[model samples]
Target: MKDTNHPLPVIVEQAELTLAGLQTTMSLAHNTTMQLWQTFGPLKKSIHNKSNGGSYSVQCYADNFMSIPFTPETKFVKWAAVAVFNEDDIPKELEVLKIPKGKWAVFSYKGTISDFGKFAQYVYQEWLPSSGYQLDHRPHYEFMASDYLGPNHPDAQEEVWIPIV
Candidate 1:
């Protein structure tokens, strides 16, 4: 795993992502995220989007509670799919991220979806402060590195990637 304290240059590339329970029908976004932590441990994954409007937007939260529906079937489905970004590519949203190319700090966490909230807290309260990095405004994401049948799946692991200056 890459050290969270060190900065690295990343290539911005568009990546296709499929989220099983990111939709409104699902009531356990936080729970699902925690389950992911329990399964694979923890790791950071990259996300991306296209310069055009048809791309999906990526989001990271301080908590596992996602007010937005995770799927496209809902009326509030704000994103089509999650994407990982590489440096030099267009920002991963219909609207621009409004940031210049640079290095970013990466972190990894894994476990059950229910534990995701704690992991997020660690990033904001613990990791970011001690890592000597400033948070960038670029869109970050939770990459599903391992297969998770559902939010309750015991064998799920996810990697979270964030952009930092």
Candidate 2:
């Protein structure tokens, strides 16, 4: 059944990445998060704060990202992710990915981490289902690139990339 009320975004099929480096694993609910916020506060966002319990199996460095299954409904406390890209024709210091070729659903979001989750909800709840592509049970992640001068920069841009089949 086509959902006339929900509109889907254009889906791009490309195998640009295969793995990603998750520099940090954090949840806003935990008290230990202060340390992380102090260090990487510039790039951070609030994901769904679920009391039902959720855990993310994330790994740093795309090269070491092993394929694993994950539950979609299990909510996670979101955080801003910054991409470590290839510089000077060479991979960046956090070089950790070698994508053999896979599908990706890319979306762009601007501003602070405050509205990050809302953007995600727009994708997962609204975009994915209407687009006709099912979610790939893999380690999905976001890409942090663009003019991010620091946490204070309001124009900071981010690319949210989810692995798709």
Candidate 3:
């Protein structure tokens, strides 16, 4: 069921990471990604001992997440964060998430954030099912750096990271 236009992902092994930022409960139907980033973006300077990898937008799904269709009400934790060297001095307003080293599939995409639904649909419904790798329980995320042009810009580019076993 692979679509000829679908982009393939790059499989890689990533090291463990400790991220410091803000988290919220949300779903596709109730997406607040823009607002979250809007609030967190300027605060990045307040973070200490951060990594040079830029900003990380992470989604932590429930254990049964992949087993069922992703509905609007399907709740998950969305974190707007940056990698930190350690959790010793986090801002009181932010929390830390420690991601263990794991295998992941990285997809590079360029488009407005609003247009990402189709891309995700293709990945989870087609590419993932057809590929040999299964979704791992770890969190999924997007990495955006100097190239990121913001949410509304169609030229915005980011690397989508999907945890896989």
Candidate 4:
């Protein structure tokens, strides 16, 4: 694990996504997200719009957001989504999520996905409190590139975006 004390930089942008997944508690998030990928993978071609900066699969955590403490019992929504050029013509089974323009603390994570919890712990429990920034009311997410390998792949890389104010 690398030093998570420092984040990359803050960025603000509007994101349009088409997601298909489940609403689960923190304890079940890992398994749930994996299941989401398995279910969404075969449907990727159908859900993605080529004009929307290619397809970027994402995991969005929302619900209580920053208003409540994060625990195993906390409920949140997790999605396996692809970016889309337009909101029209969305598949009936999928849900659309728009991440409004806001500041984010972007952290580059390199390693297996299973270790992500530790990184997140560092970010929320340590980094955020001391960084002089407050958590913004938005979905926290992870942006995985199209070429991303599975959780155990050694070279896997992803960016964890924590919405902040």
Candidate 5:
């Protein structure tokens, strides 16, 4: 198992996102995420000036927040987005997502993007159950810096933000 000795920090954040992506199942998330990035990637430069800060690529697991123990068939909304300063000037092709203020369990992940599932498994199955906190009702997300390499890059780094109560 990956290291779980250190305690992950919890934080609260407010975010405004401009997204172009898809709604899909966990089993299909990988392909769908790639598609979203492909569709939204080229538009990145045009949207940066209006961004709030670092770009955010997020996953909203349900229409309303739900507890854990989700299955592979669970539906979720995946987005390739950037943090926008405001909702204004959003392109017609994109959607705006506002992440409400809430507490989050933040984990620093450095590896191939495909390995995220393993880390997530560790979080939910191992760490979270023993951590004394429950998963909160909010979207989970990945914060990617402007210089972030693609998913398959060897040295890719990002933060996995899991909403927690």
Candidate 6:
């Protein structure tokens, strides 16, 4: 079996992004992102201005989320979205999100989505510590496309994008 781990990131100046999709309040302690996506996937066709064929999984941490004893209700904003040209095509119940241009460190992730915890640990604990870049205030997101079969697919692929200063 292929080892699941995170390698170094490719630094880049990400362009501003405009997106529209479902939004909810959740915590990583009891992640319900997949459930959110399950609801969003079938309705994706309703979005008429898709800028790309891929989707983005975005997380905006709560201000106090880093506090000790983060719990299931820590409250973070989760988005299962896709890039769009504008909000004109968005569904009535969906929300719009705008990500400003910023510097980011993007890592290529492979293997099942369940391995993300370990992969994230490697990125935040091992890689970030020596990467000379600190986390930025923007949301962290993943760009999934081509090889993205499903969350549990052994050969799934995605780009983990971490905002950096």
Model 2 stretches with alpha carbons more than 4 Å out: 1-10, 14-24, 31-100
lDDT head-to-head 1 vs 4, winner: 4
TM-score of each: 0.44, 0.50, 0.92, 0.78, 0.80, 0.89
Give one digit per residue, the lDDT tens place, for model 5 in 16-49: 3344333344444234666667777667656644
Give candidate 3's error at residue 63 in angstroms: 0.5
Assess candidate 5 and give its TM-score to the true structure.
Answer: 0.80
Error of 4 at 13 (Å): 4.7
User: In candidate 6, how many Å is residue 88 off?
Assistant: 1.5
RMSD of each: 11.3, 10.7, 1.7, 3.5, 3.4, 3.1
Q: Which candidate is the best by lDDT?
A: 3
- lDDT (10s digit) by residue, model 3, range 34-86: 89988887788888788775899999999988888778889999999999889
Q: Tell me the lDDT of model 2 at 12.
A: 65
lDDT of each: 0.41, 0.44, 0.88, 0.64, 0.69, 0.84
Ten-residue stretch with the least lDDT total in model 6: 63-72
lDDT per residue (tens digit) for residues 63-116 in model 2: 222233224332343332232233223223222344434676766656666666
Report the error of model 5 at residue 160, Å.
Answer: 0.7
Compute the lDDT for candidate 1.
0.41
**Candidate scoring better on TM-score of 2 and 3:** 3
Candidate 5 has an lDDT of: 0.69
Error of 5 at 6 (Å): 7.5
**Which of the two candidates, 4 or 6, achieves a greater TM-score against the reference?**
6
**Candidate 1 per-residue C-alpha lDDT over 1-165 given as tens digits, one digit per residue, 9 for 90 to 100:** 454543232434334333311221112332342343332231212233322212222354333223443332222222223223423443232222222344555444445666666666667666677767766655466555334444455555554666666
Please, what are the lDDT tens digits per residue for candidate 4 over residues 12-43?
Answer: 55454444332333344345666666766666
* Cα lDDT, model 1, residue 58: 38
Which stretches in model 4 have alpha-carbon errors above 4 Å? 1-26, 51-68
